[model samples]
Target: MTRVVLALDSFKGSITASAAAEAVRDGWLSQRAGDDVVLRPMADGGEGTLDAFAAAIAGARRRPVTVTGPDDAATDAAWLLLPDGTGVVELSSTSGIEVLGGQLRPWDAGTVGFGEAIAAALAGGAQRLVLGIGSSASTDGGVGALTALGARFADADGAPVAPGLRGVASAASVDLAGLRALPPGGALVLSDVSNPLCGPRGAAAVFGPQKGLDAAGVVAADAALARLAALVADAAGPAHPGPATPGAGAAGGTGFALLAWGAALVPGSAEVAELIGLDAAVAGADLVITGEGSYDDQSAAGKVPAFVAQAAAAAGVATALVAGRIAADADVSAFTAARSLTDLAGSAEASLADPARWLRAAGTALSRTV
Candidate 1:
């Protein structure tokens, strides 16, 4: 009997990692009932990081908290508390772009909610922090989050700065004295990005357009972030080079803020894979199947499929691929068998409309090859 390990990331808007794994498992089992199959849902510290942890870790509790949203409204969000006292906080849950719906508030959206959630997790006696900073909604240089964490930002007149980028632009002073201390185990930032806090390759220049910033707005946002960096250096000390650190620009500069708070940045996929014991699973399996929503050029760079495939290769196990859409430029040579749900459904729309169904079909087809 062939032992197959299924490690699939979320199919973006189509399906959750857990659901996708189950659907594929069902289909694979239908074809090879005697085969051993294992499900290990994967994430790259994006929108599905929390769900991935909850699915992989037994006895992980969801601690709910209400905090300020990107749009300055109260929003209910939850963080995962593992049995080992590691609190997994996903920025997307609290200050994600989705929370803004279609109302893009590039200048006004901030990450206050994300920080509040982190504070809540710390207050809950978390010994460690796994901060997932992805799908952010703001370009406030993380001032909002810092403010929520007890770091104060005041205007020249000593009044509290307004929320969002406006606050960042107006802030003349920062005080980290009141900021909460890191947990006993310290904080690790989960991010796949490598952009710096300011400049052309930075957060505002490259990511602001997607968050609804116009050309002028992007320029203005970059300036605001630069100012924040200066303030952070001043308050945290000249040796604090958080702004220039790779991944500091992730989650709309939340990474930088976390760095200021003494968090270390690490590759999201690798750290998560290690935590979920992916290497052990791959080593024991005959073949491993992994995938994502779109297997494109970017997939090779710390994405779930690439990370899984690399692990599988190191163990001398064959690999297969199942994805929503396989881009023409995507190199899929790592997988012995590759299937695209879009192709299986005959169109992207149909595949997206019913991802699970197509995913099951893809699973069955791959099983046939096996």
Candidate 2:
């Protein structure tokens, strides 16, 4: 009997990692009842990051808080507190584009909700913070989040600025005087993107289009991010984070703003994997399965699948993937075998409408082969 590990990333917009792992385990059991199976839910600093932490940490509890959302509406958000005094907060839960549904507002969306949740965690005696800044809807240069922590963003008239490009463009000064101090263990900002805060490869230019910004809006957002960076550095003095730092452009400059608060940017997959004990699980497994919604070239770039494959490889174990859609040009050579639910279901729409059905089929196929 094979000792298999189900370490799958959440199929965004469909099944989560926890659900996918269950289906995979069930299907594998159907094929080989005696096979040993280990479930390890995975994420790459995106939507399901908090779930991953909750699965890994003992005594992790959800702390609920109400705050203003990206759409400028009151909403409820939850931050996680680990047994070791670590706070887990995902920006997507509070200020993500999904919160607004199909109505995308790049210029006006902000991350104040995320900050409020973090502040709540701090108030509860969190000694450290693990912030997941992916899938955020805002490009406010993180002024909104910083503002919630008591950093002030003012215009030329000394009046407080609005969120997003409006605030960054008309900003003349900033004040970090009343901002909350970092926890004893500081902060770890998770992001896989290496883009700088402002430039051609920056947040607005590269990611703004997806956030519903036009060319002019992208240009404006970039300049605004630059202005925010300069103003922050001027006020913060020597601890200023350089603009060229990797991941400064993440979540619309939220990564850069976190740096201003003296946080370190780390690779999301590696950090999460360490927390979830991926290496230990893979060590004794005969095979490991990992996947995502789309297993493409981007997945190879430090996403959960590639990271899991690397860890399994180091342990002399084989890794396989079961993805929602597999691009023809995707380099999935790292996997011992790759299966696509879309390919099995005959169409993307059909596969997405019911991902678990095909995901189970893929697991059975892998169980027989692996």
Q: Give the per-residue lDDT of model 2 (tens digit) for 1-370.
A: 7799999988876889999999889888998999899998988777899999988777999988888899999988889999889998888888887788768888789999888888988998999999998878888888889999989989999999988767778889999988999999999988857778989878898778878999999988898888888999998887777777888988888888899888899989888888888899999999999998888755665578888999999999999999999988899888899999999889999988988888888888888887
Writing each residue's lDDT as its tens digit, candidate 1 over 193-248 gives: 77898999889997899899899988998998898898888899865756889888
Instruction: Output the number of the lDDT-best candidate.
Output: 1
Model 1: lDDT equals 0.89
lDDT (C-alpha, whole model) for all candidates: 0.89, 0.87
RMSD of each: 2.5, 2.1
TM-scores, all candidates, are 0.89, 0.92
Best prediction by TM-score:
2
Lowest-scoring 10 consecutive residues by lDDT in candidate 1? 294-303
Model 2 regions more than 4 Å off: 368-370
